[model samples]
Target: MSKSGITVNDLLKFSFISDPQVSPDGNWVVFVKRTIHKQKDYQSSLYVMNIQTRELIPFTQGDNRDTSPRWSPDGKTILFTSNRSGTNQIWKISFHGGEAQQVTFFKNGASQPVWSPDGRSILCTTSLKENQSIEETESDAKASKEQEKEPEPYITTRLKYKANGQGLLEEKFSQLVFIDLETGEKTQLTEGSYHHNNAAFSPDGKRVAFSANRSEDPDFTMISDIYELDLNSKILTKLTNSEGMYTAPNYSHDGKKLSILGHNMEYKGATLTRVWTLDLHSKELICLTGDWDTEVNDVAINDLATGAGSPGAVWTANDDGLYVLASERGNTHLYHIGLDQRITTVAGGKRQIYAFGLDQHRRQAVIGVSDPQIPCDLYHVSLDSRKETRLTEANQHWLLDKQVSLPDEINFTARDGLSLQGWLMKPVDFEEGKKYPLIVEIHGGPHMMYSNSFMHEFQVFAEKGYGVLFMNPRGSHGYGQEFVDAVRGDYGGKDYEDIMDAVDYVVEKFNWVDHERLGVTGGSYGGFMTNWIVGHTHRFKAAATQRSISNWFSFYGVSDIGYFFTEWELKTDKLDEPDKLWKHSPIRYVNEVETPLLIIHGEEDHRCPIEQGEQMYVALKHQHKPVKFVRFPESDHELSRSGKPKLRIDRLNEMAEWFEEYL
Candidate 1:
């Protein structure tokens, strides 16, 4: 029998549950199940489970990967997208079992399918029409050159944020499409130069909702507003057109109101993305929770049978109420939010409540939770009985008596008196007196936070007998907006001091931490900090930076959203404010560096592209500093999570090995 212990390997193989859907009658639930196969070096698949029997079934499988599973309104079939057909295309399978059939035959791929209310059509978003590759005719070009002595006008594509994963900006545009279940005819609902993604059909089937940045803000990368489309006229109208990004829209069962995930631009970093409700007729928007800093992982817009307009909107099935995975006291937990807006804790500890969706009856829920030792697993959490039962036994057998250490959550004050949050882990068979090498792991985002979730990379450092320290320094979300925004324009100042203070605190408090053998590693913004730390101080013996930004001047135009995000964070838009962006750039202080560095980057990363890593590697080599570079091909900004799974594993292994060899 497999022991109920978490291991570093388990973190490396952790899976996720996303785009959860409940059947029409709420009797069955279907979701995507991801598993990382080290042998194959990939993660893939979709799964279904009966709410009543808890009998798990794998719906689609093969060499082709499948995901984003949604049940048809009548609940007799499952609609999903698969790469099994060479490219991602719509495919369906009977819930009763047997072979899955391909649905849409369009050359372009489709994803994120939603079933229309009457079950006559399926609503989804696709770049098929928008992605037409055009070749300039040689004859037309020759004629134009002879006639006007001017170059032929090739197709000029104008779109928002297309340079990332999907290379080459073709004439293609992302739009909403409706497919007839019987006739198989496809109707383009909304069309234009604007990109439409992550759409959902209204409960009444009269409208489809989506997120887009149609307004003429060349810097509109951050403004993703919610829009609703009229099915009859095929006209699109804006719903929530605020300054911030509005996403994850879900229609209430009654069709009178809509629930959506909203991120206000006023603040960034580890802040909360709240769940807001808007009345369709009145257009009155109401903020659902005051706990704004806490993340609302997934919300179900349920119209309860017992209470209709009870303010909090309680949905009870199997005697349980609405539950949300809320972060509190440094950890995420399942909580019951009552119709009266009263909150009660269900489960709390050092764990992550990644995702959850209601079952058919609305009584019990299929919950996905994970900790340091366990990868995510689905469970049935009863509302009335307060009982949680494990559902799928996916990779439970892989963990056999592997020992892992639980993190010691610690709070320390920076030199400037700002409080910082961190987690430390010692060796599994830790020795009290012997000083162990320490590794400081920094999280990216500068706006993102370092939560107490199961992280494989950090665990590996611990397993290799290195004391690990990771913290939410200035600018990390999870705290209030002011705290998160504190790091802006002050990058290497207080934030750097804060990290140095953390090392000071750990060294003083923990007698087992080796002061001489210190190392640092981080990705993206965290990677920037890692590079910055080594350049400014030689305290760390070694360092590894991933997908980092070495120079702000080049990053502004080279990265996808760097032009906007860099300006926003640095409070400067152009070279006129060169001093501001430069003061915070890591390359500015490379002359002070003494520690050896390893640079890892994704070749196609648009967020903080490969150039950032190249600049650092070139500078270090010129400075005669010991350095190395590892570039992953065919990867984007999400190399850690969505890059080639095997490559991600190797990336982590390489970082660990670098520190082990140098530190």
Candidate 2:
């Protein structure tokens, strides 16, 4: 009884898959299954699948989110985090099947549960206020007293005081915690005003390695160094130099070395992440992908896979090398890195392998993949035979009756002779000789890549009889480091040309595309481009910009990453480059915009801020140009990807109608 194609509300029917954890013996895989709850919110539960039979069984059916499933050493028990008790906490369940038992009762809740090598204790992450002790639990008598106090003014002298999703940064630190499985006793391992993440225990279970910024002025100096802590002596040793951003440290199987995924900030946020190995004994660090141009991580931009855990370096059983995901072109494929620095693709293709869990024996892996046709599904991949077995088809039921719009790859050359690539999805159920309007969709990150991964918005656009054109300009990832870093210091110069050229290529090559009925929309940097595109040219009949930056001068003070990102990307600070900022601002040319523009933004968006949308809307309205503004409350930078379900549907409807009206 469902529709033939994907609809705006059909998003509720799709199930998101993420964070697949393979059992030790490679017989089973437990992963997080996320589904929408009638637009109220999202529900995430853990599901276990037998590798051989491909039979999926419900493991945990928590009302709220239950994630981070890890197998015990002996594979008899599984440790995970759940929020069925109102807050996320550590929980354990036997492999044979039974009701889950709560393990940690931290007052702030605990997550990122990692079992120690001996399986006697578990290490997790928990946040604590400056004065609050880790001994504070839900059962503690002091918890009730502390909860009664009124909120105080936010006092902070630090530069980094806020994040996008999480509002004002509290005076809280995510410290390392250890909960004993046998005694059920919790102990705080690290203490400071800093946060530690990506923790892993040494093979002997005698030491712990984590990434943190323990340097002076942790806010101003954006350096994350790897550190090792001796569980016995309680002595912490700084492993890497405080020069660049480093994270996701993994200890070798033999406990002799550590593999890390990071970059030296050569291009700042646009820098390609490379794999590095640190000799724990010699304290020497080496980048294995130094000569390799491919970025070492999943760069595919996916909006479907919620809570998809990122893959890091997985040590081989023999300790000679490690397996990691590499982003080359538009696809994220698994690659093996040997000690000799040779990188070879193990499982690859056009699909986006977002999350992967290795077996460590070089035998097999469980990967979460999403392509243009598939949302996200688990697959069993053999590292030796290179055979792939489809594990779970979470969206197969409804997808079987839906007509998916498959994207055809497009490779074109920019006016400057720079090579560029993108995809164009024809209108679903198209008929020959019938002209259709084209909608140009731009991606936000300017730093992230938009691959052939399943995009919900793109599907909806194509389903509604509009040809969708999305391409990677110069600043997209999956390309080499130089191509991604090219947009820096040239926001609207060549990057704008690359986008325009893609549009030109599609319109010229396709006979069914109507040049007069063209529309454009994008968010963040893409939003900026949409605003810029309308101002620079009147080719687009309609335009919608979401969470966009209109004025560079005002954005420098309002945005969360405005100051440093301006310096890194724009190559100038507010004080030093006022004229340069004004020159690049789309507001400077707002009077030239003739297209019917719809300005969409999130009220709580600290990243781009709603003010940007307001400025663009006001400028256009003052000039009597066709413009409209719609703001989403209680949403931030992640509005399109993970915003409120109702708001996301509303956003899609707003854009589709806007295009349908003028185009």
Candidate 3:
């Protein structure tokens, strides 16, 4: 390895691997590999690997993004979604290697392909016009092409009219459709004005289970229930009637039970997701991990690469158990849950398992893992022996000559007797008795945890001779439901204390930390906290907040999820207690700010809209406070994680320069 430190340019050299799916016979594994080209854009392609010999070969080639690969039931063919035909659609390719055949021809495109258990049909999701048939949609397209086009005005009717990345509402809903393999005929399985998500076929192939909000007031309520659609009768049965969000339903091997991940919303957005089993015969629901403290999904957020989506609760062959991923403390690990309600760790350590595919018969799995020093790679992990064999080294050459910083795990107690967990990364080239500037980094999703994964932003800060400290405060996942729920209705209360306590512990324990030259920065919820910290106390010399929320009063009506999110998180009825919403807003305390602050926001961000950053900037500017606002064009709430490659680098450089000038 070279003695030089890592730089922003080094990010393009790393490759990201995700969505590993093993063939039925356990002989081969197919996965998606993504790479950044000339720091312009990301290109993803599918690849296959031999289990025994560890030979890797590319299955799909080209610049088009190909992802979400799934093995056919017979193991003779592989199916995936690709945009090679100009738009994303399902395509099928033989396992022996050949040209992929297009399956769907929808104008809106298709995604999330799931094959039937008998391999006769494939189910996918595609957006369709509300209350309009496929023929009508095609007719409208033809007419629009023939006539001279004019700018159309947007007429708003729905409560939620715009999404962050999807732009303005189009009166379309995502519905399920199935394609017959033999006849190549397409049929719409479900239709509605509401959205359907996480659709899957039952083992018997007689019914389909999916989650949707079929209520009359779906725009006002955030409730979704699991439903089963009978193929022959065209009857939809509600399997769950809870008040919370329920989704990602998968049938057991025997088809007698269903496993799902959800919460009752008792704690609102901070509620921990648990695995529940439903008896199809008796209609009895039981939470399998009711007593478990960890959150039952992947919450390891990082900025290095795009993450492969999770396929919840992979069932075993005999239906006696299932494998699921859980986030605990600072790591996401695979766990096996038995029918008797016992939980056991299958493959786990101080590492993040981003994605995995299980072969129950062979007792082996193909998993995507990464750590502080490793970007990400695939490995063959044996469930019984707990032995992990490296299968791919996509980043070895780029990382070989780079000096990366590894985090030191930390544990400390909050003033309220709460145990908080975090990590500290020292400067890359450390010298004895040398004091370095400390930067306290906070994670978004007050519910998301800062886990043991590769973080490009943190490493960049460390390389610039700064000590980076990040932690899971009171509202973060991986902890129990109570701990995760503690931050709700108390936004800047205990959550703020937990972060400040973390900074205090680091400053007292580490002798090389310059307490006078401290910096604080975070995005989303963390951004709100950064604003809160500087407003409440001027402990840090400089602060940078990204995609933040300043005033909850205006946010309730303007944001996409504002109406419910403000009520649920702030624990106040916007109609009844408007003052409570303003009480927790950072803009309420802006006059107390004395530190040099930097505000970064995405112009198209709907989660925390640009108006939020604007409100704060205008207030600070009017008060003659030292603050500057930077706006990124065509970016959303995910700018730091999956925005354009060039913009992401510019964002990092901007933050570093702000701290370099102020701190």
Q: How accurate locally, in lDDT, is each candidate?
A: 0.70, 0.88, 0.88
Residue-wise C-alpha lDDT for candidate 3, range 529-550, written one tens digit per residue: 9999999998899999999989
Q: What are the per-residue Cα lDDT tens digits for candidate 1 across 66-85?
A: 77677776778888888776
* Top of the candidates by lDDT: 2
lDDT for 194 in candidate 2 is 93
Q: Model 3, stretches more than 4 Å misplaced?
A: 135-148, 360-362
What lDDT score is found at residue 654 in candidate 2? 95
Shift of residue 15 alpha carbon in model 1, Å: 5.7
Clashing pairs in 3: none
Clash total of candidate 1? 12
Clashes of each: 12, 0, 0
lDDT of 2: 0.88
TM-score of each: 0.87, 0.97, 0.97
lDDT of 2 at 394: 87
Lowest lDDT 10-residue stretch of candidate 2: 302-311
How far off is model 2, as Cα RMSD?
Answer: 1.8
